[model samples]
Target: MTHFIRVLEFSNKEDALKNFCGSFRSGESDFGIFSVDASTFGSLPSSVFAYWMNPSVGDAFSRFRNFAERGLKAQVGCSTKDDFRFLRLWWELREPSDKWIDLAKGGRYSPFYSDIHLQINWKDNAAELEAAILKKYPYLGDSANWVLHRESDYLKPGITWTRRTKSDFSPRFLPAGCVFSEKGLSAFIDGGSRKDISAALAILSSKPCRSLIEVQLAAADKSQAGGVANSYEVGIIKSTPAPDTDAEVTERLAELACRAWKQKLTLDGIQESSHAFHLPAALRDRLGSFDPPAIEAELARIQAEIDAIAFDLYGFSEEDRAPAQASHAAARTDDEETDADDEGEDEENAALIDQTAGLLSWAVGVAFGHFDWRLATGERAAPPEPAPFDPLPAKSPGMLPDGAAPFHANAGILVDDQGHPHDLARLIEEVLARVEAPVPEDVRRWLQKDFFPFHLQRYSKSRRKAPIYWPLSTTSGSYTLWVYYPSLTSQTLYTAINDFVEPKLKEVGADVTALRNKAAARTRDDEKQFEALQAFELELIELRDTLLKLAPTYKPNHDDGVQISAAPLWPLFRHKPWQKVLKDTWAKLEKGDYDWAHLAMNYWPERVREKCKTDKSLAIAHGLEHLYVEPEAAPKKTRGRKKGE
Candidate 1:
């Protein structure tokens, strides 16, 4: 017998099985089918039992056998007597090879010997077989239901058993009915037919029709709640179908479009697409169709009305406007130019006034001094000359002097009308005294003098020297210490001035030298302090920067006079020993101990202090106390247990 079979691949095995089983009963008579088994189904060489049942089914079966021989030798050879026993049904009527060929053609008659070839149609029976399995195994009911339905429609309506000619055997029919007696009975139906076939298949493959007696029995059982039981409950809440009204759908679509537009706009900013898509077509068209000339005319009319109102209120005329506005603008420009010129002149005048004031103040503070000399009687006066480089003569004839004044000379003793000594030594002493303790007025007058003592001496000598005796006085005078001798009075006067002025000049020089040394030491101290303060300030800035970098969210509160708390990872300034040092350093800095603070803090604070002190706003904002660190006590050591214990 020959059977027509259609094979299909489904989205999944369950879908294939559902198609097969759902068409089980109705498919039987239409297709003229008797019984169906896995052995009569289309070949699926991927399954092991199918390959064994239909070894020569098709090209795929031949390939599958070759693959199995090489790959699955252990599984194929391990089969027992029962594995090949499925062929025993027709074993008495046909050889093993003939039965194999028949099964490969979907349970049709073998074509090897064309002895009375009968047409057998088993497509409907195949679906019925799937449904019967699903009835036996409820777990597979849904899947089998679909496969039964699919198979009934895929094959012709009635079962037609036909003969296959010799050499017509193929593997396509092997998968559907192979392994029917063993695993196929429990096997899931593979519902793999297309949609049109699926629903028709379900109606065709329902359970077999029952006799009147069987129907009566089923009715009695149902009345007793035993047969054809309704096990499912109807759901109370019914789902409403989607609205089909055009307006409702249109509103929904508009809402969705708006939401999508907003989402896109938020993500990508306001751009052409967002704006264009957001507007309705009608609005865009209306805007595009607007009349530019008409709008412009309306605008002009409004502007004219405004102009008329302005003219009525302010007495302005269109024709008189231009020249008057220009004149007013020119006047304003001229006024501004004049003001700028005045400002420039004022600046220059102020500068000149400041210069004049400074000059007058300087002039008022200068000092003046005067001197006059007249030589003693019998003393010679000499013209002004450079002083000799020799030491002053000794008091004793042969005693060497300890030190000498290089500029000392035997000049005449002179006096003014007030009896002030006009000797060179006294004059030198007075001049040196003025140099050392120079009043501003005295220094000024001294600076004004032309030849100084030389001019005075010339005047003194001309006034006091007798011409005849002057020559004798110049050559014959013996140097004497006593001023009582008129011949030695000039030598005595010069010597006494040297004696008095030299020591005081030395004293003044020493005082200046000491003052310079003290100043130098103070400067060094100041520099050290400044350097230390600078380093401290730098460290503080670095610490602040580090803190800022670590916690960007931190913001100092100026109103609250306390340092902000630091992040957990950042060590507070107060936690370190350096804190105490900083505090001490800060205190010293406040007290003008710049050097002390610099050394203690190990950084410059002068820069920091100057920055803080000069800016009152900054000083108050960053409280001065924030710069200081509070002292903390050292940790105590724990005592150990006694050695004896």
Candidate 2:
């Protein structure tokens, strides 16, 4: 078997072992080579690798629950304004939604209530999901019994390492928290303190260590596609040497790793307040000042320093470092190949759009009173309450009158004190300003052209598309109404038309009439005026007809949501657009472009599949037909007793 030994590539082999000392001695070193082929190497006994590798809990569909952002109440994780959507909660039917509420567990005081943790069914019974998981994969045992107890495993003192069972990517070590390990990946639990974990990660990430691992894996038989020949079995990992238990070195390596990880959290815009350690004063003082490149450079610097430490631990001579250098160089070349990903535009643009979607969704919630006003607008001093049942005379001085709170419960941006809904554009502008992001140029044009398509792509997942906002429109693009999900009903369609479409049609009709009257009054041959008048008349006719076409969906006592099937809401903003809209949305969804499972269309798959024939296979591949739909049991048959009778 071919072995990719680091020493083979080194030009200078002398003086390599003079400065070397085995700290942990987890592996056997024969001569200058660390080979698993040696009899004693794989058998080197050690406790550092005694980890409880969690089992694969099947596909993400069965174990992962992602809440497409419904409202502020559905938001979860340590996400900050920048990466707010990094973690979103799965809606729980039992969670309170009638009044002011925060998604934070323990009502905002719990340290980790807002941070993302390993969770199943963010809005459902987690225990039930766990039970089902064990029932199907009983080999994982009743409790996934491993080398150590799992009583406080989530919060246990240890480092966590993740390796894809089938991917070619290098392993990654993350700060241990609540995370799920499914069939594709192996997670090593129970290392030591956060610092110890960092040290372990540093060693494993070193060039020599990675080279040794790659050789071993390549020598093993390839069992899966898109993966190396060998799995990162516990034996292979255990046989890799660990840095000697040097407290000072461990602490320094840990500091660098911890700092780098913290910077990453910051770069992603996760809320710093959610983490246990406060950012150094220097970093905190310059909040929002660091850019992506700067953060990346700092992280890279830390990694290089750790690599240097690993060299000393493994006693690699100057000549033996070529293999490690070559590996890094190859990684760099791969990155360069894909450097033109977005035509050299800022990748943050995508992040910004994603964040914009989140903000708009949050605003919709605030408008409908699904979320507390203070959560978005920031908390303010409370208004004084009225004295309860005081028997004071009306003439009493210095007494305040009984009054309501500053903000009404369930109040939204759509309507005002007079119960009149504002123009959709006006409400959106207010929401944009509240979130502090600039409204894209030509906000209406943006929505008409780009936003809906982007939104469809964002939520296009099987059994998961829960769009909280629905757009109702006529096929001709002659009229449109945007309605909040929580407030939608058949009556809402009628009310929106009455409030927006009907009034606009009347105003246009009056304009056309006046134009015709002026043209009639003018005796001179006014060719331009006649032409303009003709155009206005045509527009008025189309608008009136569009309104008529939409009226049926709002029939009284009808279940508009069920009957309409979002029919009046199509051709999305115009007729025949559904062909491209459904095609593009379904294609991207099938390709796994979107992250969450909340596409509004997924709820009614059969209707869409029947309506759009071209993308049927794509839809089916994503399991749309059976997703969120129950399977019918086979019909029971009874035998006929003809001869006996």
Candidate 3:
């Protein structure tokens, strides 16, 4: 380590290594250079040309007792460079399943399994994306392949993670039929056998592996520009300490991981946003009872088992596992205290609290014709089963065909009125009636007070608060019209007015007139009823007028996605945090910041039209390709035959 050697590009690395080792043996350099192949690269990626080699990188590699990076095929995935043009949320596209592959662009921390929300334009082996890259840089010539680095590895089973290690070193298992991203770096072992994969997943998701990876990223960070790394790429991971897992230990770890994965599905299956979601876990078999704490505890128990086996495989002493053990114990204690607080209520009431809520949520989904009624009603023979990495379904099993749901509102508009056939409560009751689950006594009150917030929380995942069922309520929350997000239209408010509000208002008006005509004979109870009906009449009239005023400008476009589409109706959402978010979004929309939205074009046609002429993205978003006016060239001078005449 006395002197350093820096050389120009060599024709052969092997020959260079031979000459370098010979120089040290011949005493030309004081330092002894024994082996100079992968050892020289240290923890640095062999593919990356890093000359800022630190001595500690080499020291980290020496600490790995039995593992080598060569056993795994770790590589970076494709980068579209312009994601907006090529990517869409799976639901955003029509007939998405045939042309689009699930895109694993690493997201929030979800270990073992997570929903892959994005789909790439992989219609013709990424032809569209490749053509775009080539057009952007024509000089790239035949090497445009750099844009899709190691693309041949697409749709292969691997362990994937965000190349930038955040506070949590969460790595998820990526099964076949996905194209990874640069951010979603992946590694696969030879053959990718199920047993080997299970073992790898077990190790990578363990606490010990998480600690090691973080330390490696910290070391790698020092070599980056300004001593901060934007990414924890392949090299840092390859250099992290790994166990030479024994066969028996491998099987045990895989068993625990497999159990943990299924438990995770049970947890996520209740979630409205997860791909694994089918029926809520508690209601999947029957809508009776389930202990949420117990399910969580079982999953935690499995995770602990995985960590224990992984720690032993890594040859860690009792001291090394103590901190993690203590952490798990503390978590368990906290969970026990929380569980004990749940008073011993009867099973039926317990079911009413959340188990029934889940069933009702599913029932509402059925009423809206979004979820499968058969699954909730037990008319369907079997529950939907899902693999960890199956292609996200365009229409999942148990979901009813588009026109088949009996309770689906004709115009996708359901009202709070008790009189209407398409009343939200009436349709939801229809679904609940088909199933044997305990229904809340007053469905209308639940829909008015609890349902939207419950549905909003269920559907809101990551940055998207996309509740498919939206409640557009009156100022006093006296009336509500539920609009299905997928079916919002310029005619929706008109449908609400023509179908529900006017009829209810007319009935209330007749009652008020009758009460006044019999004024002298009216009882004290009759007077109170008349006054209440009068106030209700006023609220209904205001709601109707507001819709009439807003209808001229309101345009609902699903392509704007749920949030932007819901922004214009911000005043309707009650004091929930989502209302504020929608309000801010609306403010931005009015300011011409979101002119790309179809709603924006409807709201401010002239402003969006002008933007469409200059910005192709806006034009594309609005489906107004004609608005992208190409600049006309200047006319050339004739000069009278070049003055020779």
| Residues 392-488 of candidate 3: C-alpha lDDT, one tens digit per residue | 5666554555556454646777777776777778877877777656678988777777887777765543335567887877778887888877667
lDDT of candidate 2 vs native? 0.38
Report the Cα lDDT for residue 244, model 3: 74
Per-model TM-score, in order, reads 0.11, 0.49, 0.70
lDDT of 1 by residue, 233-316 (tens): 001000101111234333433333223222322221111111111111211122123333453455344323332332232233
- Per-residue accuracy of model 2 over 379-483 as CA lDDT, tens digit each: 432223212111112211111113323222322124311223554444556655764545655555544555545544433221223333455554444345555
Q: By the lDDT metric, which is better: model 2 or model 3?
A: 3
* Model 2 / residue 289 / CA error / Å: 1.2
Clashes of 3: 0
Q: After superposition, how far is residue 382 of candidate 3 from its true place, in Å?
A: 3.3
Local distance difference test scores for all models: 0.24, 0.38, 0.66
Provide the lowest-lDDT 10-residue window in model 1.
Answer: 232-241
Candidate 3 stretches with Cα past 4 Å from truth are: 1-60, 63-68, 71-109, 117-157, 162-168, 175-185, 188-198, 218-233, 241-259, 287-353, 396-398, 401-403, 407-410, 426-430, 519-525, 624-645
Model 1: how far residue 444 lies from native, Å: 5.6
Question: lDDT winner among the candidates?
Answer: 3
